[model samples]
Target chain A: MKKETLILVTNDDGITAPGIRNLIEAVRPLGKVVVVAPDSPQSGKGHAITLGSPLRLNQVDIFEGIEAWTCSGTPVDCVKLARDKILGRRPDICVSGINHGANHSINIIYSGTMSAAMEAAIEGIPSVGFSFLNYAYDADFTVPRQVAQEVTKKMLETALPPHSLFNVNIPDVPLENYKGIRVARQANAKWKEEFDERRDPHGKKYYWLTGEFSNQDFGNDTDVWALENGYTSLVPVQFDLTDYRLKEKLEKEWQFQ
Target chain B: MKKETLILVTNDDGITAPGIRNLIEAVRPLGKVVVVAPDSPQSGKGHAITLGSPLRLNQVDIFEGIEAWTCSGTPVDCVKLARDKILGRRPDICVSGINHGANHSINIIYSGTMSAAMEAAIEGIPSVGFSFLNYAYDADFTVPRQVAQEVTKKMLETALPPHSLFNVNIPDVPLENYKGIRVARQANAKWKEEFDERRDPHGKKYYWLTGEFSNQDFGNDTDVWALENGYTSLVPVQFDLTDYRLKEKLEKEWQFQ
Candidate 1:
């Protein structure tokens, strides 16, 4: 019997999105595919789990030739559910997104796409989150498939670092004109959050979230630079949030009684 | 004239929670306090931000001395909003939470309390997140006052490490019996996520999120250990997710074209 690879699939864009459909199509030939994704889009859910309320999981038939389930929880919930209840066994690999928007720079801190991948990595499973530079309802995902396919193939053959995962973002370019891949650092970019204040029909004041992406780091070795240059950006990410350099200094300065 | 200190205040337990009110009381005398927080409870929202829709802000007269506003967003959003819209200048200090529960070990990843502080730290603001090791709707916060005051004063007097913030969890003991503070590391502990399946009144199956906290770490210097020993735990955390030790190995193994 061939070593059947169990590829756990999920996304923040919900199960019915074209991105996951494309992902499922590409990875179906590789091995056994199991998709546990949110029933609705969970774009900025971050590392959130479903603790506030009860979660519901229903068997979904959104994608053919793949075992699928829709979760009434965040992206992290999908991964947790797949690992504990659905798979019950350790999966060979986990892949999240082909997200509609970029999970680059500071955006990673708020991305449901990267959080799903981070959840898998925290569980000691090799995982990757693929995203696009474009943020639209129907952004082009043509170039993403080829890059995503190649990256997935490489990971299936070789293992990633423990407690580490990839935040891969592809430029919104055509497949034919796309440059290759680039291993880069997360760019020091952030959103200058500006809310668009407006009034509802009932004259109730409301605000819409808006922001301008500001890239401060002009280094060529960053994911933002790679995306701007039309290359596939792969930034190695980890879950250890400790500021190790500050640790020793703090220990020495602060008196612990 | 006293130098007008810009203080940014936020919380995970919603803007109306008693926790933020207690926090506001502690910090109001020290600076020009600006309270921007979620309209509803966002306890487990993590580092989430609103990406799909616009965020709303409502000016509410809650706290008497502090300038408070409720945001239609996550805890991280409150920080961002305060940074951009509310504060006239860059905040001298940012404080999140007098949280109802502990943000010990890996729980910080899914904690909106810590995330609000982490967001400010990323923006180069001196930040601290204060939590008590108790989970109750009407938990007593008296024990945390001295610890919170000390940490806040220290951060104010001597600026904290850039890209670093405090994750402070006070012991749940009485004020007199509480052991002193401890400079600690995030314990290598995690929630063993378990889902409790039950049938809804509408005849559909639902699952309640349940987890048992597992701490296999035996190190005395860990946060969990400190908290268990009746000490307040302060762990300095950062946003750079790079595992630099593995960088050289990954660079050699995986070549990016």
Candidate 2:
């Protein structure tokens, strides 16, 4: 008799979202599933960790048969607390978010969903973050779930490089329309930010952060190109932020005493 | 008459923190200093932005003659708000911190100080984040200021590559003990995290995030090595998180249909 695999699941869209629920459902048959996620929506929280206050974790009956916990912290906090407090050890692999929105390119920099996966990678766990291009509350996670399962199975069967994780984004298409998966590079895409200014009832000036997607990278091998062409994009993201090419250029040209 | 160079400054320690105040004073002579920062401390907030709620900006007289505005958001929010609202136009150079603590190596991923600068880099503004090895409320900023002055002058005189910024960390040593400046790489270091799990008065378990700096990289050109040798470390950081080497490996080996 062989022991069952342990699969840890988490998301940034709070414990009540359909995305994580669907994720648990998809991965449950493959392993003993455990979920630890944020209690409230933590979109765009990035790689934030709670430092200003103590964190409280509560056992919740959200996912009927699954052992789930709600953390009163960011997505990264949930991963850290899950590793240090709940699990007491690292799992076989960690998976985060069948997220309701895209986690491609520059968006990953500000994404709590991918941040959880990055945290898992930093802790030496093979990690993958799943996201759909749709931003609606009831966005379909069906295609994303199937893709996640395939990706996760591959991750478990094979070993990834040390300190590396996957940023997987599924286009908002039906299963039949899915054009398969492509391992692509991060697109040079960004949000052209705009703030909607308005006066409060009490005459205070306030702003709402809004933006539009601007993709200038026309490279056929980039994530944006793949996703736009109806394929799911899988970018192997790393924690090292060093620009080696620029570093070399600076060392040669911009020298200082 | 030459136009006064507009310099945008911010930090994670809040608008009223001594670290940001020292930053303003140091950069004031080089430009028409504008300090748009968080109203309260936002340490370890990473690249977080407030999307669920509205943001308010208030003009403050905290820096005396220097122009400053307090934002009800994270450090990254301050930079975004400053760009969208206050600055209205991109400044010649964006500088964050004189941070009270070190943001070298992997710490930059969780640093509100460096995130603010990264936000600027994403927006095509040449940026730099300065951090001190000391993490005291009243850590001496004298040597940090001198280093910052030299760095900012070079930035103003040189043109950095697009989407690239500098992460500068100064050692907490006297000027006489300094081993000079080092154009270093980010050390492959991490925090050995320990969760101090304790029970509250109500008998509920909570966690306080604590960690020890684990420097495993023996490279003499790393930021950790430079700081340990009493040298200010300057590492050029970039926003693109793609591991090109890993991407090439995956492309050749892991061909998914």
Candidate 3:
């Protein structure tokens, strides 16, 4: 008999979120699942790790019979702990998110959901982060559940490109109406940020971050285009941040002392 | 007379830390500096932004004549707040850190210092993050101070490539022994993580995350190689995480349904 596939599942929406629960149900049949996730929401936490504080992890019965632990750390910490403490070895593959919202385009820069998967990718594990375009707590996971099942199944059987991870985003559409998945590029887009200034009860001023998503690229091959066209967009993500084109430009044209 | 070059300065080691103080002094002569930074150390905060909580900023006089503000947020949040609130306009360039530790290679992925600079780059500002290979609270800033002045002068004179940010890692060496700066690539590296499990006074177990820096690549044109050779490593960093090379490989090799 073949060895059972070991799967690690985590999310940024805390352990109790409907999103991760949906994800667990969708992928449990694929392999033995172990979940280590943040005990509280870590939505805007990028690739943060806890250095100044000690972390606590407790085994919980939150997912019924699933082996799960709620961790007091960032999404990345959850993955680290899962590898070091829970698994005692690398999991066959790591899957993060089924995030509460879309992590498309430049939003990936600030996404804890994507960061967790990226951490696993850095560890040379084939990993994928799944997100629904919907942010609602009650957003029907009917579409993402099917996408997760399909993607997780495919990932189990196939090998991803070396050092490359997947950012799988399902468009918020009825499952039957969804078009097929498209491998796409991240669109050149950004949040046009605005600060909402408000006063506390003590009259101290504080600011809340708000933004509008602005896609400046019209590339038909981009994730924005795929999502807008009713397809599940899959973008290959990596952790190398070097701009090779600009490196050449800097070397020849700019002088540094 | 030249218009005063507006410079935004921040760090992951917090406003009162000696490292940020060194950074402020180094760039003092370059421009009209506006210092906005976190109130406490946020060492492992990557590109995180505060979304679940409100942010508070207060004008501070800690740097004598330098205009500064202590922010109740992460390093990335300081940059955003600097742009929209404190500066009330985009600064000519943003410089983050004479960080308390190394941010070369994989450390950059978990670095709050690099993230602050990355955030500024995302907002289209020419930016750089500087770090010492030293992580001590009282580490000598003699080398970094001179390097900072030189890099700041050079950046003000030359426009960096569009959307380009620099990650500069200084060797923890004497200024006179310093070799020339090398424009390099981020080396392949990762922390070999170990979790020290210990029991609390109340008998609950907790973990302290610890890691040993492990450099895997033998490439000479890497940041790690540069630092080991007594040269400051300058890697032109970008926020785009798409693995184009792998994207191509995946297209030709992997079949998706």
The 10-residue segment with the lowest total lDDT in model 3 chain A: A155-164
Model 2 TM: 0.97
Runs of candidate 1 exceeding 4 Å displacement: A1-3, A136-140
The residue-by-residue lDDT of candidate 1 on A111-229, one tens digit each, is 99999998888887888999987777687777888777888888888766566688899898877778989888888877777777788899887666787889899999888898889
Please tell me which model should have the higher TM-score, number 1 or number 2: 2
Name the 10 consecutive residues with the lowest summed lDDT in model 1 chain B.
B241-250
Query: TM-scores of the first chain across all predictions?
Result: 0.94, 0.97, 0.97
Considering just the first chain, candidate 1 attains a TM-score of 0.94
**lDDT tens per residue, model 1, B1-257:** 96788888899999877788888877777778888989999988888888777677888987885678999888988888777777868898999999988898888999999999988888888899999877776878776866777778788888566666989998888777788888888888777878888898899988888888888789998899999998998888977675556555667898644
Cα-based lDDT for every prediction: 0.84, 0.89, 0.89
Model 2: per-residue lDDT, tens digit, A26-104? 7887788889999999999999999979999999997788899999999999998888878866787899998989999
TM-score of every candidate: 0.94, 0.97, 0.97
* Over 4 Å off, model 3: none
What does the lDDT come to for candidate 1? Answer: 0.84
Model 2, runs deviating above 4 Å: A1-3, B1-3
lDDT of 2 by residue, B39-139 (tens): 99999999998999989999988777988899999999899889888886889899999898999999999999999999999988899999998988888
Task: Report the Cα lDDT for residue A31, model 2.
Answer: 84
